[model samples]
Target: MGATPYSLVYGMDAVLPVELRIPSQRVMMEAGLPEFEWAQARYQELHMIDEKRLKVLYHVQRYQRLVEKAFKKKVRIRDVKKGDLVVKFDRAPVYDHRGKFRPNSLGPFIVNEVLFGKAVRLLDQNGETSTEPINLDQLKKYYA
Candidate 1:
């Protein structure tokens, strides 16, 4: 997580603009070395680039798994079946205190078909069917 994008991709630390203006320790260290020796040292560093890339890959995969685990904790699994009655959720923001006028959800609609994973087709109370599929989150089981 502490890795910079340049380091992740290049397998080495970036030479900042500040370092160029005011010489850095690495530049100072390489200053006195012979040209052939410096070339040998650079080759060694390049040889280890693959190892650094592998380490970064491992870190990224671990982070992704942690995120997936945290996300799964808040998930609620909803299951519905054909012929089961369910109330469709109302998306409206309005709220009414009066019992007679307050209707937050629609129908006791019968489940007509269960579609691909979590989507369901519904038949309204008046025998009219909904053309579009509704997500499981928008439905709650109706009792009695």
Candidate 2:
């Protein structure tokens, strides 16, 4: 028979007995084969390695879908619109030298305009618009 694909490409078995025990090892040992013969038989099984890889891929994709569904369920769709009152997250609050008890957000700013993508332009209490657009994730709706 031809060499297994793994042995052809890597010049070694895809799995070594020391790393993972072969299920047939016990049966081969009971058959009174020498240690080297048992090892050779295990190498012959490596041709099925592609099937094992496919099964792992199927499990990984299923796990990823489950995680994605959980994440999407927890995510809130922001309904931010123009003229909405919102607070911006204070990204550099630690650098302000404020105490640890200080609030981690600033401004009940007004949404002056909704920009392209998940961004918005804001107007402070003074009604002056900021020059740059802010990401929607950085702003939370202000209640009061």
Candidate 3:
């Protein structure tokens, strides 16, 4: 548009054929255009472009922060205590989701104490307690 408002190209740095540039530069010099005017025009144009770019960047950052906050929610894990009736996973079928779909839970076990790992001591509904510890993830707290 209107010769791109200004030409910041100096012939020395261009990869264009020398024949093409020499003739155009000679014409510009004859027209009395000063090199200083060309340099200043380039600097002003870049400043405007940079300012607009900064504003767009700032707006995008604010939107990202808002979305992150909206997606954020907290979950608190409750402590398992003694005499709590709980469900423990079956040993043979860790891959099955069918039990989770049904009421696949077994127990109403009483928690005796925590062992090493997520393992805990528990007493079954019939009063049998496991000697080996089990992970808490396999169990759910029984309300009734």
Q: After superposition, how far is residue 89 of candidate 2 from its true place, in Å?
A: 1.2
Model 3, range 1-144, lDDT digits (tens) per residue? Answer: 333323445423333475243334444465576877655655676687799899999999999998888776443364687777788766565666665675566777899887766678898767787887878878888788
Question: Which regions in candidate 3 have their CA more than 4 angstroms from the true location?
Answer: 1-76, 94-102
What TM-score, computed on C-alpha atoms, does each candidate reach?
0.65, 0.66, 0.40
Ten consecutive residues with minimal summed lDDT in candidate 1? Answer: 19-28
- 63 in model 3: Cα distance from truth in Å? 16
10-119 per-residue lDDT for model 2 (tens digits): 98656556544554766666568898987887776675677788899999999999999999999999989898999999887365555787788899999999988999
Model 3 TM: 0.40
Better of 1 and 2 by lDDT: 2
Off by over 4 Å in 1: 1-30, 93-103
Better of 1 and 2 by TM-score: 2
Ranking by lDDT: 2, 1, 3
Which ranges of candidate 2 are over 4 A from the true structure? 1-47, 95-98
lDDT of 2 at 140: 97
Model 3's alpha-carbon lDDT is 0.70
